[model samples]
Target: MPTSRSSSSIWTYLFLLGEPEQQQRFFKELHFISIVTLSFGVASWLVTVALMQHRHALDTQSASLALVGMVAGVTITALGKSLLAIVVSGSASVLFVTYGFQVLIAATDDPSFWVLPLGVLITLTIAPLFSGIAWYLAVSLCVWVMLGWEQFPAHPQQADQYWPMLAVVVSMLIGLSLNVYFLVLRIHNYQAQRELATMAYTDSLTGLNNRRRFTQSARQLHRSALAPAYFLMIDIDDFKQINDEHGHDVGDEVLRKTAEVIAGIAGEHLCGRLGGEEFAVIYQGDKHGACLLATQLIETVEAAFAGERKVSISIGVAELVKGTDLAHSYRRADASLYLAKKNGKNRYELAAS
Candidate 1:
């Protein structure tokens, strides 16, 4: 059962790193990755101990410290906590390297000497692979250096095997530094992708949700069985004449102001520009509520563009029927919109309840 629980925890933790969210979320993603690597590092530490001639290879104090760090790191990671996990995991890394190096120093003349340099290289490489969290790497490197200084060869000629270890450290440092640099670049690229996605769903002229966004939101609301809602199709009355007479610039300003009025009226409701001089809105309201909103929208647009542009809106509204999809509801609203235009523009026509 313990094994099963541990496996479940690990898988759950692993799945949480789906994607980097906002800027702060990037740090959380880094923490998650660090947590996973720390777990494997601890596991490697234990595996090395188990492959030894003596089960009690580590001193009682040091062993206790390592176990505390490893277990605490794992527990905090399981709880989705990070700061304490960072601290404990750093300490665990130190103990793993230091204790392993101590054993290596003692067995320098034995066949185990072949494994010592490899262990040191692995420790140095993995510790700083997490570039953003420097405290852990600093603490681990300091512990390893302080504990193993005496283990270094006292004479230059005796340091032949040690040069390869230094070479490994240097190579790993260069490669890890490049990896960190690229990660920063990746974050910037992710930010760009986010901006591009926003642009794709946004109307460039009116700064409103584009048709694509409206379709997505409307479909979602319909599929979720949300009743007591209304869909509205709005068209600017005499828009083509205004553009043809007043020029495109004035026409653009009129569209912008009209969109502002609609957006303000539909606060927290979905409002999107369907295309040139046409828009759509979805609100969680009944026929009466939608009528009130449509009235306010018509009055506000008339008043807003009264002096300069002098424009009004024609709106068609339909209360969503149960089991009707967004496309059907929108089409019903569109039919009403045509009736509104036919009834001498600057007014609203409601679809039969």
Candidate 2:
């Protein structure tokens, strides 16, 4: 089942969505978040003055710049590219957070320097999740440097200012460091999971869909089929002989080559390996088209070998009728497969029943 945007662990869900559709959904989540962040920027400016003890209103110019940057961020996101939005958002956030922190300091009393570190915490919490590693480091470094600029122009009069700015730099570094560390681990884990999924659903020898995936795909295809759907069961002829005469290594290569041949013909259709030298194809088309495909499979494999080793396949195609599951259609194809072997090998048998 697909996850909703309101999923509890939305960040993890977005990263897990590597498929085309899921990726699109992930960006939609980001799009919504960007809107929220932009709204918050506007609202914060309207209320920043009220939060001050002296009732000193913050710099309207800096607030305006921040709002303008966020509007640009939201507008760029409307173009529908999430990565671009991240860059734009990160750039805008840096601009706003830097100036916003200054305005916050201006509105504060003696411990005004402490407000900058708090701003660093807020930026670290909000910024890194939307962007990649490069953008994260870039934005975090910019925030630290912008705050730490006062460190270079050290004077006895301004010595106290260095302490809080140093605190802000340390805060930014630690927060961003933790973010990078966890992101690396999560990405590695996700890649491992994806690889395992591929291994589980694919045949190791042929790189074709395995039996489990084949049955699953066939069931799905059957449901969506408008006309007629066929399950073609294919078996390599004298496969045991090849293994016995040339060893399993050559036999494995033959199976891989055979899978490629079938896959080449299957094209937009689905094919799978049913263990050993047996394979299957789920096709949607007319009986004549299915028969033509089976014929092509037979002729192509028989003529594929020019070396001392030659291979052939016997196919059994069963047209799935209404209210019939893959198991029922498979039984008919199995019977047809037996008939093909019982009569003559290197042929295809169509089960009309």
Candidate 3:
């Protein structure tokens, strides 16, 4: 459906990465998790600072930074600036990790803050391709920094610290693998939605817009139309007889071939198969152009199947009026279609204004 090469490439990239509608969905998810995680971090830090104020002086500046960053990130996400939201929130997360690591190291020489980067695993799962990779690397860098900083500054020769560090490394590996698995699942779900939408909106037999899709689109076009518009109601002449005489297989071939011909000619317009042996096209042009198109459809279809079997079509033409609904225009076209068949099939009749 993408007409240009750049657009097609962009669609392919989006498909490969994850949800095509990634911006809004990613921002919303990020906003939600950032709110929850950052709120908890700020509250827990505030409580810790309060309880430890008398015993040991603790810095509350990082907690204040986390609160402010969360607000800014939520506002950016609401504005649909997904990349910026990630950057803001990620900066806050970095502050939390670095500050928490410092506090834990100074007070108890504990490396428990190693698990903090695991919070960023959710971002890896939800972010777009480049962003996901960036988060993964950022989290990895944070973990490595904490491990190296803790070793170099204190307990560099402590053999018992190696086991806990090893465990943290293994956990990061597992979390990264799981993030990849969930990202694949997310892409599969988005593709499934697209396939289901196509099945619902497309005609399986002719590959045209089904009646439901056609009516919805036609009504919207009618309401917004600025140019002169016309509707053509078309039917295969004596289609039942063709099916009865030559088997249904032959009838199906005729329908498919006819639809192809109509689509080729009216491909630029709103062409669709209304029902069995009935097709319609909504053309944007004057009366003369509409009549000429109908004539072309009759001539082309006849010439396409001339050697195999005689196939012809009757078309009804009705100009769309600004004040009238599409249904009224359809009825007018249907009336003219009847007359075209009555006066002798394979002809077109234009409905009077």
Ranking by TM-score: 3, 2, 1
Clashes of each: 0, 0, 0
Candidate 1 residues lying further than 4 Å off, grouped into runs, are: 1-20, 23-183, 225-227
Tens digits of lDDT, candidate 3, 167-210: 55665566566655555555566568778888998888888888
Best by TM-score: 3
Best by lDDT: 2
Candidate 3 minimal-lDDT segment of 10 residues:
122-131
Span of ten consecutive residues with least summed lDDT in model 1: 11-20
Tens digit of per-residue lDDT, candidate 2, span 1-353? 55775453445433333344434544555566666665565456547545666654566687567567656665665564754555466466545655565555555554344455545666566553543445556666665555445432234366484675576667767766766664555456656767899998988888889999988988888887888878899999999999999999999888988999999999989999998889999878989999999999999887886565678899998998768777899999989998999889889899976
Candidate 2 residue spans exceeding 4 A from truth: 1-102, 137-183
Q: TM-score winner between 1 and 3, please give it.
A: 3
Candidate 1 lDDT over residue span 1-353, tens digit each? 46987776444323332132533444455566665666776676678766766555446565656566666655565464543444455455545545554543454344334433554555554543343434434554554454445544334466376775575466446545654564556457667977898899999999999999989988887777556888889999999999999999999999999999999999998899999999988878777888999999999999997777679999999877778777788889999999999999999999986
Clashing pairs in 3: none
Native-vs-model 2 lDDT? 0.71
Q: Which candidate, 1 or 2, has the higher lDDT?
A: 2
